[model samples]
Target chain A: METARISTWQFFILALGYLLGTSFFFRIGGLISIAKQDAWMIPLWSGIAGVLLVLIWIKLANYYPGNTIIQICIQVAGKGFGGFIALLYIGYFVHLSALITRNLGDFMKINLMPRTPIVVFHVMFLLVICYAVTKGVETISRSTEFLFPLVTVTFLLIFFIALSEWNWDRFQGMFHMNIWTTMKETRSLIGFPFMEAFVLMMLFPYVKSKNRIKVSFILANVVTALLLSLGVFFTIGVLGVTRASHETYSLFVIVQEMHIGTFFEHLESTIALILLIVIFIKLSISYYCAVSGLCQLFQVNNRSWLSISLILLVSGLSLGFDNILENIVFNREYYFEYMLLFAVIFPLLFLFLTWMKKGKEKRKVVGSQA
Target chain B: MIWFILFIAVALATSIFMMVKQKKSTKEIMLFSTIVLLGFADWISIFLERKFNPNHWIASFIDWISL
Candidate 1:
């Protein structure tokens, strides 16, 4: 049987999917809410934690090279039980995609199209996602590789544009926040977007080279951290600490005020289009992962049908949230911990389980040789 | 409105075709299809619950299922 494989570059895209989507819009409130005036510290702390966790994941992958998380679970925990764990992961992945779709839909509706029905944005986004998944991971990966340069350039351009309006008062008293608040926020910050890159474990089976996976994973986390920092810093500086929390994509508001001259004003729409492109790329990869995990768990012969099914399912999920307020409320209340369980906790647990299994297997081999 | 419904129907139909053509066993296909329908029903209920007051029975049944 032929197994579909993706190149190293695609793996990078898969990681980008996890980082760019969740962090892009929401990282500001998450950072400022915790770090207060010392928002930059949040990224530094989270990056340290993120890199360490990713290294743990890399070490596990090295132990069992070329196996997906589901495959590894089965190897470590035997067929029946491992398959059940894999099924649980499938549900987790599905819930994740639903949350992402719902959030993106909420953001787009509130920010870009107030008059147009929310379903319009939802359908269009999912339709594009469905098309991308049908083409397979390579398409999404290549698209990410292709657009990554533009996205980066646009991101930097926007960051610099906001720099002109920097106000240091928003970042004043950098370390003055109570230590407990900072530490608590630091833990929540670690999970939201940075450590969430742990989801890339599922894609480990597809990449050709197992060597240097750690280097790539750490590099991805660092780059993501820097981007998140840039976004949060600019948001706080431009919007001020108070208003920044209310502005979901506060970076856009800063850009709206920007003008090289009078001719270049009201730039929010252009920025929105670029972000829309980035979000779509992010969504496609994530939706693909959710579908692929399901296919593998069910042992389905072809996964393309899963993509089509997701189109409808995601469309519905996106609309399930009544508005941005409910979405935001749910995210903080339940979604954060829920995501950690599947994306972070389970993978870490599986890593430990795999390590124990390998030790036992090694002992058995040594005994036989003796 | 008609176009929207037709578009969704077409998407579901295409998925069904691809699902069959790919030769996935009926069980898997059915599972996927059921998820799609269930998710769609959940969304539509939220979309039209109060506006279509006459359909309270349908809404109540969906609520009972509790997605």
Candidate 2:
């Protein structure tokens, strides 16, 4: 178990930053291409669903206070099966971190450093992440406290600057797409940043002050969703839905479209800066969770022994997809179902088992007293 | 290709030496070596042009299951 506990505000910032890496860069771009002008609404809807699912995650975490999801699994389920579940959760953390790392790799290779191998970007970033993870979770969460505000402020600035090119006419044919098709196209989102919060259960127990943790989480989710919604709306409005839908990383496209004469052109760096900062925080949290989970399960307190190996493993797994298109297809088509197992299904199943165990304990107590 | 292999070898060697210096238990070192080696094998496969992509397998499974 982690000895260092963070304040509720730190938890809020970590969660907010994690969610705000704004998968919108990859996810909403593709979704807007699907839902067209009305796609911005998807983030809002996903945010609400994400908020409700987070309540379930918290309920499960509170049942075993001070225990991480991995620890909770071992306690609730027998060691053999519980160990499997714990490993699965650890795998989730590693897998998500890898996917995001690959996203950064792809982004860099395409936009900035075309000559450099994609693996180079991943290796450099993972090396930094390995250092952060070994320092422990408190250090990472505290760093997010400042980075969150910085990234959000710059994100707002970028949006405002891009407002020069915004066009209401871009939204002219709003709901021309079939309703059911739009819903199908966007359903995977709730599983994304939201159900993805399912992983945050690992960090919930380490929050020192739990008094307003739920409030902080809910507010953070809502704020991130709204910000991402604005991003979607801005992407469609500025670059037009047709173009943004086809392009990967629509947010970058919007920033590229931002021009205040030649003097203020090529602000790709600003948008990339925002994405990198927030994604770093998100990646750090997941990296920390995975490494620590491995340590606890194997009874090793020295995380440095494991962080480097995990970094190497993730870099290799991240390249498992040959192209970004394959990854996007997985995210859009099957990722929700895959995530559902770890996010909602297993958590709820464990919650039910917890209730049964509690009932049995109460019965034993009554018999003893009688 | 040879240079990239050397980079992997040097990285793995440095990391192992750091852990040994930190006096990590043998069991932990063994676990670390196993994972890092697996990672090394995968990376080498990619560079060797016999790339192995687990995503393709999962995507195909998803398609086959129609899920």
Candidate 3:
């Protein structure tokens, strides 16, 4: 038996890790920035696109029952070359961790600390992340199980509070833009957060019961898409296209501008804290995956050491961007392609190669039997 | 700033000490260290940048969609 056993609740909580990070926060801004007033449609279409990507993972998991992508790569390509391909995946995982961690840390700086050096937050955040990883995946899963409810409640509360400010008029001019342009912008939407469902592959192995894995995976994507769609829709409706386009914390701005019981003003700090917690959880999980993937790639018994190195590498990369503008520049031109390359293109190729190898093995077996 | 540097110095020292004393692999330490350090960079940047531009690709999707 595996040393760690995650109950159904824990798996569901763990799945939210997909939603809370780049997808929910940073990526939303990108989509809104592109789709503008028409951004709501992007998520609707992108959600469908996301479902299709998640299906690929489901089919792959079905074909290889009880095996991970790493194991499947070895089975298909054989040891030496298979290991090379696995390394590519490991590299992708690490890059993703760095990207997510950087984004989380970036958000913290913008929201919480006006004076605190970015490095301070980076060290503090990673200390917690490393500790969480060291405790292993089960501990994180259990904590997520508890924290998930609070995260959801916070989101719902914010959504409800901002509802009074909703202007149907803001959504009035939808699709006034050319359809083809909206479609092109939809690519950015599909690429950013929706395609991120591919990360489900790494987590799918841990989901209990073979039959439930695919179903649960699809359900998770649905939940994520719904939440994100609501967030973008509300944020756009309340803030209008102009403010929503450039606003970093658009939802929080909506909340701040919202009037309620007289005592409820200046609630953005609370919102910031809530987002921080969610994003931290996100970074930790991705960091853990990267570390764990590396250990598996090299056959290391201890992952803790790799976790430390990854923190430093990510920090250096994060700092290397100089400022937020530079970071955004890197993310746009470089990270966009990088996301598709890792999450979509590479995984599909792996699936195809595995299928071909399996077919060849069947033919060889039949020949021998004859 | 001094305190911050000192804290990082201490953490780095402890990490090195743990590295040598334990039979742990260098790769593992490197991975963890990169995560912490890079995570810090992210935190600092967000805190520092007040008016962060969300669009990086410089795409005119807003105009495109608005049109």
Candidate 4:
């Protein structure tokens, strides 16, 4: 299979889109509920932690220039154990993609079309994602680059407009510290939007500018952190922590409250449009990763068949969730830890083994030269 | 139920079309068939009065082991 190469800028856009995707819609309420008025600080701290994980991924990518995480695992752990680990990672990606699909389906069912069956949303969305994946990563990355700027600008516009309704007193309790609570909230943040950046490692081999991978990673993280922190800040300021925490989709509520001199009222549709774009990019990337991982795992030369099949599988799986509330609870409670295990703990272990192996090979080379 | 059937039909049609166009290997065709069949089985499980939720099962397993 010929690897599709994407420019660093496109790669950065894809990362930013992935980070802002569902997290922009769903994370604020949980963050506010946990951190209260100080929720705004969580993204900044979590973004720093995310960068450390990115550094680990970059180190591993530098070690093996053209290999995906699955290949890297096979090289590090030997074929049998490494293949098992690779399957686990593939499972994690597929599961994560299904949840994101379900989340988007549920969001639309609840907000945009209450009368429509959730499966309709899931199937239609998955069809689009399947098409995008079959076209390859360069197509997805290029589309993300074109859409990223528009989404960012619209998101910031909504943020600043919501600032009109901001009450300065919401920051009153900002300085009041709750060390344990903040730390607990930070764990979920890191487990989610931050640590989830590790999925981008699968795309590292596809990045055209190898040396600028780190720069693109850092830039994407910083921009995402700023955007998310400001989102929390605006949500708390406009709605207050109590209201923000109580609302399921706080950003939607915030956008609804934007009046724009009474002429441009009820911009929830515009907000919904933005949400759809970001979520589409995020889901497409996840679908691509999962399908591509399966191709690599199963040694399938043609991915179109598997891509369509997996799309159906994911759409079907998304319907398996009992309800939106259950989905939310599962994500906040279980999904984070599940992702952390695969994205962090396992990768770190593999990186250590790879390092030891490199050292041994280096010593052998030195001895041979002597 | 009708929607489920329609979705499955479309999926099957696409799989067949792709297999013919690309001349997919036997392994690829078999994998596609298995996935499509599994998806259909899962969809029908709802009507069979079975509470089949792989998502919840996995989540419960994770929660159990973590505990």
Off by over 4 Å in 3: A329-336, B1-67
Query: Candidate 4 lDDT, tens digit per residue, A196-289?
Result: 8888888988888899989999888888888899888888888998999999999998888778776999899998888888888998888888
Q: lDDT per residue, candidate 4, B1-67, as tens digits?
A: 8886887788688867878788877777887888788778877876565736766887888979878
Which segments of model 1 are wrong by more than 4 Å?
A: A1-10, B1-24, B44-67
Interface RMSD of each: 7.9, 1.6, 7.9, 1.7
Which has the higher TM-score value, candidate number 1 or candidate number 3?
1
Single out the weakest 10-residue window by summed lDDT for candidate 2 chain A.
A20-29
Better of 1 and 4 by TM-score: 4
Where is model 1 chain A poorest over a 10-residue stretch in terms of lDDT? Answer: A329-338
| Candidate 2 per-residue lDDT over residues A265-362, each given as its tens digit | 88898878777887789898888888888887877778876888887789988987779888887888888877788888888999999999999999
Q: Report chain B TM per candidate.
A: 0.63, 0.73, 0.55, 0.63
Clashes, model 4: 0
For DockQ, candidate 1 versus 3, the one ahead is 1
For model 4 chain A, the run of ten residues with the poorest summed lDDT: A177-186
Candidate 1's residue-wise lDDT over A161-245, tens digit each?
A: 7777788777776668776667664565676676556567777766777675676778778877876777777787877877776
lDDT, candidate 3, A66-91, per-residue tens: 66667666766778988887777776
TM-score for candidate 2, residues paired by index: 0.93
Candidate 1 vs candidate 2: which has greater DockQ?
Answer: 2
What's every prediction's RMSD, in angstroms? 5.2, 2.1, 5.8, 2.3
TM for candidate 3 is 0.83
The candidates score, on chain A by TM-score, as follows 0.91, 0.96, 0.92, 0.95
